[model samples]
Target: MTDVAPARPGPAPRVVLVPGFWLGAWAWDDVAPHLAAAGLDPVALTLPGLEPDHPDRGSVTLEDQVCAIEDALTGGADGVATVLVAHSGAAAAATVALDRHVDEVAHVVWVDTAPASDGFVMNPDVEGPEYPLAVQWDEEMAQGSMRGLTDEQLAAFRQRAVPQPAASLRDRVALTSPRRLDVPSTIVCTAFPAAEYRSYAEQGVPFLAGLLEYRALELVDLPTGHWPMWSEPERLAAVIADRVPRGAR
Candidate 1:
């Protein structure tokens, strides 16, 4: 009888989605299913204080957010690597998780934001049990991505928007593991082209300075307002699905 070879294992197919300020896992509702259809398992998360009914947002710090992401990344099925998708201000929390669990993370997709540098606070001046929506809709509509949304959709968004915790925004980033920089990353740029973003980095903008630490970085431009997930979810999902590690796909 001929000897038989053992079957090879399939790719690690997992992704964790993290949302930005004043939003929850629901923010990814339109995108997650598409990722799932592409053969990747997507886990969308709501951070500690971003919940609409959370009572003690003042005590929720950046560390709390970091811990939540770390747990989600590592707590997946054994031997399966995970990719992290963090939007806006949540990129800081995702970066900390990448730093803490470098080996377990296959890649990171930052939506419209990059990781902040050490000592950088997300929103320092917002003193809040919860920070309220402060943007002027008319100005935002003129220059923002919500131009495609209907009046009813805009009203629904405003109703569902929750207050972000002050502590999470105020805390400075603390990255200990430099190896996190070695992990591959993609920045999905919305509201700006890749060239403009690169220019900002080259011009030494303080916020863009952290991009220097990334050893393997790719910029994917998806021009829309800052919140592409809301305005162009199908396109956003397609872009993200393309970046999922080939093995996982």
Candidate 2:
């Protein structure tokens, strides 16, 4: 008789999730269900400015976004262990918040998102080929894309995709890496190449702290569109589950 091998164990660990640019906390709505089943609790929230109907959306800045997440982490009396997940532009904001509040964060997941970047500094050419929704003025309230939106979704985006603060993206980013964050980080870009307006090609290694930070990064590539949360939530959740271990609290 042949000897049988032992079975592999499942992963564990809860995470705090953040969304990319032009996306509110709603971005992860589809993915949360899968995470819930896998025994990973996802702590999700919208950044301060991306609300559907905020009166003052343009005034939102990087500091403001970071503050909102920091408040959520520190607000509760019982501290929870969270692996921070950031998509797209939110990566910059998350970078700042995590550096300041690492005591509360366990790991960081970058999903087709920019790495820890400088949100405060920018080149003088500044105004790029792209603008918020292709519109220069913040008051217009448009930037970033909604990958799997329907007609109704597009309308909703048109209504809610508020103008990002000019300073947030234009300003130089301020993020520092503490040694404690060395082991828990993963960068998940989609399996396919980025489309004209859908890819995160703008993000490069320069964005990460190759020198100062001591984290080992795992890159998980999956076959899906830009919006994996909507197009392939189950698979995305599986990929995420692989990176985070359970009972990390």
Candidate 3:
């Protein structure tokens, strides 16, 4: 009698893509296909309040966002590695998720933003029932950020952009787990150079300071704008595909 062999599992790791403020899963539409081509599974999330016609923006807090990402990580198939990729304002929620699920998450990729420290609020002063998207492109760009976006792309972004929940920005991130600092992390520098970001971390900049705690920190330069998914989707996907592992860690 011939012995039957068990079927081997597919890929070990999957990439979880979390878009920043005013963006939904649609933001990753361009990037996901490329990741798939590179043999990676990309799960792009819209987040809670950012969804079109979502009930109440004010009710969505940072913890709610964190929980959403956490559910994604834990709900995946057993023994599958997971990489959390967060863009812009979503970094805080990603950080909290990494803190809570340190054992399960393999890597954290921060695009144009860094993890926020405990008690940190992204924009506490920007009072919001919901923060409206800025209409002016020039005024919307932050210093070196938001480069490489065309006029048409800008117009499209403005038209589709949703208002960010106030609580998500104003509520503090509460992280008690110190083990989160042990996870490997990569910071994709889009608006700023890697050297400049490292300098900021060295200087004890509040937001960037938490990066110093990471056991394995990699600074990758994407050299685009704040929204690389819109500006350079292929390049963004390539960078992410290269950094994330294919097998369980």
Candidate 4:
């Protein structure tokens, strides 16, 4: 008798996509559907605290974002060990949430974002003491008081980039120690810099190398600006599908 491979059990691992600040879950519009085609359940999630409609948009904080994500990944959700895909600013909150609830997150992809570096690591990257240019930098961020898209991209971005609570950026990520978590992570780094803001902006991947677990997940480099989802959705989705949990795809 010929030996055959045994079938895998249980539900397919899910890919939960989180957009950067100023972006709604809709940012993952093109990617999630592609994940679905590849046999992974991809869904873009908007943390509860992110409400564009509210006048007091500043009410939200990083902790609140993490808590909301915690509930979204709450036990008895769709699948086990779900992959958390976060872009830009969301990487900070996603890192905290994963550390807080390790079991819930199987892997996290920091796509064009920071790795939530510990104390000293975060200090140097500070925006400095100027509004828009430096201080009040959080508000200057796209999620904050920054400008939005053109006439064509306006509608879509408006629907997606909702009001992220101000507290999220104000509150820092809590770190017990300067140690890297064992949780698998993938950094889908972009080839082109979104804005020539700072030196490290050009070397984002290299900067995060000190924090991310390069050995754990595949590090993909896409030739595009910061928002690959908007510029090159198909390619971005392909990268995500590959890094998603093995059984997931």
TM-score of each model, in listed order: 0.90, 0.71, 0.91, 0.71
Candidate 2 has its poorest 10 consecutive residues by lDDT at 135-144
Lowest summed lDDT window (length 10), candidate 3: 1-10
Error of 1 at 129 (Å): 2.8
Better by TM-score, candidate 2 or 1:
1
* Pairs in steric clash, model 4: 22-143, 24-160, 24-161, 52-163, 60-165, 60-167, 61-167, 61-168, 62-168, 130-135
What order do candidates take by lDDT, descending?
3, 1, 2, 4
List ranges where model 3 is wrong by over 4 Å: 1-12, 139-143, 246-249
For candidate 2, give the lDDT of residue 41.
Answer: 71
Query: Which tens-of-lDDT digit does each residue in 53-152 have in candidate 3?
Result: 9989888888888989999988888777788999988988988888889988878889998887887777789775898787775554744567888778
Off by over 4 Å in 4: 1-10, 75-79, 120-151, 158-160, 177-180, 191-218
Order the candidates by TM-score, highest first — what do you get? Answer: 3, 1, 2, 4
Kindly list the per-residue Cα lDDT of model 4 for residues 12-35, writing each as its tens digit.
567788887666777777677766
Give the runs in model 1 whose Cα sits over 4 Å from its true position: 1-12, 145-147
